[model samples]
Target: MFNKKYTIVKNEEVIPGHRLMCLNAPEIASRAAPGQFLHLRCGDGQDPILRRPLSIHFADRGRVYILYRIAGRGTSRLALMARGDIVDVMGPLGRGFTLPAPGERVAVVGGGIGAAPLFFLLKKIGKIYGKKKDMVRVFLGASTLAMVPGAAQIRKMGFPLDIAADDGSGDFKGTVVDMFRKEAKNLALDRVYACGPPPMIRALAGAVGPDPAVEVSVEERMGCGVGACLSCACKVRAGEGEGFGYARVCTDGPVFDLRKLVL
Candidate 1:
């Protein structure tokens, strides 16, 4: 969890309104895990006072990748940065997804930009589980065909992948949760990891019922990346007791058990 200014090695648009920024930060990269994020200071200005939090898209060698959507002032500032520019970042923060034991049937779900981290997760699994990679399947969704995440890479890796697009532009023309529900009826998945819109997350929770096999990487805004501030609080089941308790997403998790989440 280092906080420092890192040099931007590359910044390219993967699609309109979305940019992929790479930083030369070996320290953070080496420690990065799937589902972890970085707090990036968008610019030198004081407007938008808080730094924007972006998920770690990919990390390799000495480079860390950030895939972000340019939706507002913070992200807009990030978009203006070019290769060789310096960016302030605090990273590898929060708990990441847990890996499955060998021979376990695994499924990963990602929606829209949330798929960023899942790509890194899948890449690692594909590498570590090579011959047994066949046990893993992936579901990805986006608003359009152009927005779908990691389809090409997933396909090339020979993993079974199902893509759903809201605009009916992919192999499946429906919500990703719906696609998973339809197909998951037959296969008994040992562990499922997901990250996406709240509605999608909630729907997935409902679809899976009481199964604790589902783990979700939540998307929330942060005040202090290290969890000192009380921002990014999430609701989760408080066990046999009466009510729900608040969990700090920045520290307790960004990833949580679906059965334990309050939705």
Candidate 2:
């Protein structure tokens, strides 16, 4: 993990309320993995002393991109930042998702802003496994079509996509869990991965059952980005007899095996 200052290379809105910001951080980007995230200080040590954590949407040779929605003061301030601004960024911190092994179909489930981090995963993993037919499938859930990720762009890259919306606004009408339950049989999904709100993650864990091959990304409010402060603790299931314990979402994970998570 590295704590470095990076200049904002560009910031563009991919959709309303959500913007994709890229930073010039070669060291952090070079080692960044999908499902990993960075903690950024908003507006030169203003109120909200804690830095905000954002997942890596995509990382290139010398840049790392983060996709985030403007939800509050911190994010609103972030939205105000110009392209040339510099910010304090620390990452690629925390444990991340385990990539699917070769010859196995990896199914990715994303909801709302949860789709952000999966973009990196899809870009990196798809290039490696997409050559094998039916190797990658993405299921994105949203309130409507406008809220989902770039489905057309994702399909253009040679990955099959499935979309689910609560209001029947786009393709499939229902939650991602419902869509997964319906299409799982025909898709031959070998392993499942997901990142989203707490309720969705809990439901996904139940749906995935005792399967050891499933992985999930968990998000929680954070204080110190590193492990020391114990500010971002999440409850996760331990082994057979260990019951449940608190794991730091900022360090021990942002990712965990489905079977081992307490939900």
* Each prediction's TM-score versus the true structure: 0.97, 0.95
lDDT of 1: 0.87
Q: Tell me the tens digit of each residue's lDDT in model 1 across 1-263.
A: 99999999999998878999999999999999988999999988889779998889899999999989898989998999999999999988889888777778888888888888898888788887887777898999898888975688888887888889988988799999888888777677888989998999988987864443888998777899787997899998896766799898988899898877888
Q: Clashes in model 1: which pairs? A: none
RMSD of each: 1.2, 1.5
Q: Put down candidate 2 lDDT per residue, 1-263, tens digits, no spaces.
A: 89988999988888889998999999998999999999998878658677999999889999999999999988888898979999899999988888877788778999889988888888878767858736777889998888886677778878888899999986799998778767776666678889989888877876664433787888888988889888889887767776888999998889887777776
Which residue pairs does candidate 2 place in steric collision?
Answer: 237-262
Per-residue lDDT value at 65 in model 1:
96
Worst 10 residues of 2 by lDDT: 203-212
Model-by-model lDDT, in order?
0.87, 0.85
Best by lDDT: 1
